[model samples]
Target: MVLHVFHGAGYERERVYAARVMFEEFLGLEIALHAGQEAGWRIVRGEEEDGKELRLADVLFRTPQGEWLTEKAMPSRPVPRWHTGGHPVKAPLVAPDVPVLYGEEVPNGGYLAVWDGGLQIGADLLGGAFWMLTRYEEIVRKERDVRGRYPAFASLAVQEHFYERPVVNEYLEILWWALRALWPDLERKKRRFTPRLSHDVDWPLMGAGRPFFQTVKRAAGDALRRRSAQAAVRRLGGWWRAAAHGDYDGDPYNTFDHLMEWSEQQGLRSAFYLIADHSGAGEVDGDYSLEEPWVRRLMRRIKERGHEIGLHPSYETYRDPRRLRREFDRLRLVCAEEGIEQERWGGRQHFLRWEAPGTWQAWEEAGLDYDSTLSFAERPGFRCGVCYEYPVFNLLTGEELKLRERPLIVMEQTVLHRQYLGLDPWEAWVLIDRLRTRCRLFDGEFSMLWHNSQLVDQGETDLYRRLVETM
Candidate 1:
């Protein structure tokens, strides 16, 4: 069925984007946008019935003077304060107490007003969804953390303490509630809760390529800095075993088997984003090389066991389209040699460093299928404001790209790293649990990144096993 969206003039880019996401991606409906003299937005069914028109407010990007995309159009500080409706929009439409982020505050509480013929949604939820899906704030707000990523603290969701909530999904849910109430016959694309698992193979093996003396040095580091006697002994044991029988399983960091085993039992596919090559210092690409014999063996094993191999584009490649392309080609070449083939290849950026549309554009140019790299390293939860994978739109270019975004919702280091959230294991699980619950609320995909290197601790490993079971 066709849904004709009549929207206000100006910000054609913004209006089209919002409509496309709400109607096509979110509602699973064919949609077309038409500019109207009306102040707000309206969606009319192609075939008129009693439940024909669904009116929604167009409160955002509607400047009194001329246009949007200026400094004036950005969400103000203390952003996303509620605009409630006269009648309560309850569970399934929105989790209780969830407030409208962007809309006019009316006596109707500004969420929705049910009438005899149809419903009038007071919230500019489509516009709010657009603001989030495009990451409108990341472009206008020029503040970046030391790592050159837009800090989560600066984001509207986090600034207003709604990062844990999937605002876009909530907005979509409200839209669906209205749409379904209006068009009971309309059906949305079926979806199920999926655990999108990935392992960024940052540090593959502990002693695969290192000399014996270097292994001793690492053992010392494990004891002194890492404060793990078991890790130290395991490091030495792995080194000696590699020397004696070429077995590296004693290496605590050699957790690929453990990772694969759990996923295999759960009947889930795990993606390993490999570093194709490194051009910078600090092991930005990875400590291990793809050319290593053991690395190639691991790649072959992953494919043999039915896991995936994807590119972990080097640190500097985010801006360098040429570098990204070259690294992807190298990954493909190595995969070809290893006799590994995947229907689609996608991965995260190393260190979670990304520059909105530019990085997305590079991925599109490189011909990757999707990227799971939009989560904040400093905090977890709804960085893209939705858990489902959706086709990306480049705000700068005023065009959409085929490279979909399966947004990274949780990463191990983001929660466990001492300099980051630094939460204890139980605390980390609590936070991740809430996020997963929210994703499940919408039947959305929960994209999680757990590095093979970080699973060394037995306690953390146990936690992951539990996570896999529950997920």
Candidate 2:
């Protein structure tokens, strides 16, 4: 059968996706057309082969406006008697749990098939406006401080970091138009949404247009408050504790059901980090108390769905090593009763705010197996100066901390915030491209943190889908 491989102009530039050349070479297919060629697709090879071999065609190109340009003539190739799905392919789709069976020898185990597992993409804007507002205040304070050192420093910093910079503003406009053009079907008809404009967007604010941000902010804040209140009610020795521990059973967030589908789709197994005392005093704005029953049920559901549960240390938990241990102990009991492993290992500090050396000491004392919270507080670049996971050592003591640091590369809030490296879609794309290049070279995982709520399909979030697709 004819195997067609369309090499679009832009797609050819992506090194990750450029393996089409090798694929074409192995298939012995001749390109009948080059879609993005200046003079349209000109057949470089014809029926020159003495025998009938499969021919491939480049059938697509990019127009000036970034739309795909396609050609009309189609090519056909002889189907091999042994070929299936247009080619003689091997194991096109494998079952999720297909294990290799060894003949005889010691008892057989499943066959080992390996693929690049380090590559990943995600975003997080959890705590939404709460986190952004704090960041905004911090930025203003920094701007003030810098002005004392140098008069022009404030403007320089603003131009470089703030999302309201001229470059970001121009890019955002283009990105907005582009997303609207691409996904008109997903557009909301109600103009009542104020756009989260660049100037009005604080790190705590949601997106690009103020009007739209207000709408989402109200809805999101209300939901957050409700979730917070419900959590508080549960923590008051209420039925939530019983329900979560399976004394009374029901799933909150339907986490098990949804995660099952999602994990299956991505061929991934997740490790969830649950906050032990989200509402406790000194938990750093941890005023929202979720029911113990809800939290327990969620943990059970996560385990049932084949995911691991870890601890998301409250703000003060890191401040006191003993308190951190106590928190983990309490968490372990929940896991133990559920017939799951009770060890509290992984951690992601709340707010990605931590004194590096001090926090490393706390993690070592608490014995976390891995931590995924290392990233720049003011930008979305590599904080540890590396793209790969490595041991995090205490800066003061110069001793290796007893944990692995999986540096977070991207978070949704960082890009959308008015402070920090507030990037629009185009700038975000440039960042992604650079990160992707590094990942390709080092074969490193682009571990990202995207909050579930930030996946909303409008306003300043235009780059999200593109980010995912590019990766």
lDDT values, one for every candidate: 0.83, 0.39
TM-score of predicted model 2?
Answer: 0.45
> Which model scores highest in lDDT?
1
State how far residue 11 of model 1 sits from its true place (Å).
2.6
Minimal lDDT window, size 10, model 2 = 193-202
RMSD of 2: 21.9
Candidate 1, residues 394-450: lDDT per residue as tens digits?
988888789999999999888888889888889888988888988998999998999
Off by over 4 Å in 1: 49-51, 63-67, 80-94, 106-109
User: Cα lDDT of model 2 overall?
Assistant: 0.39
- Candidate 1, residue 92: the lDDT equals 66
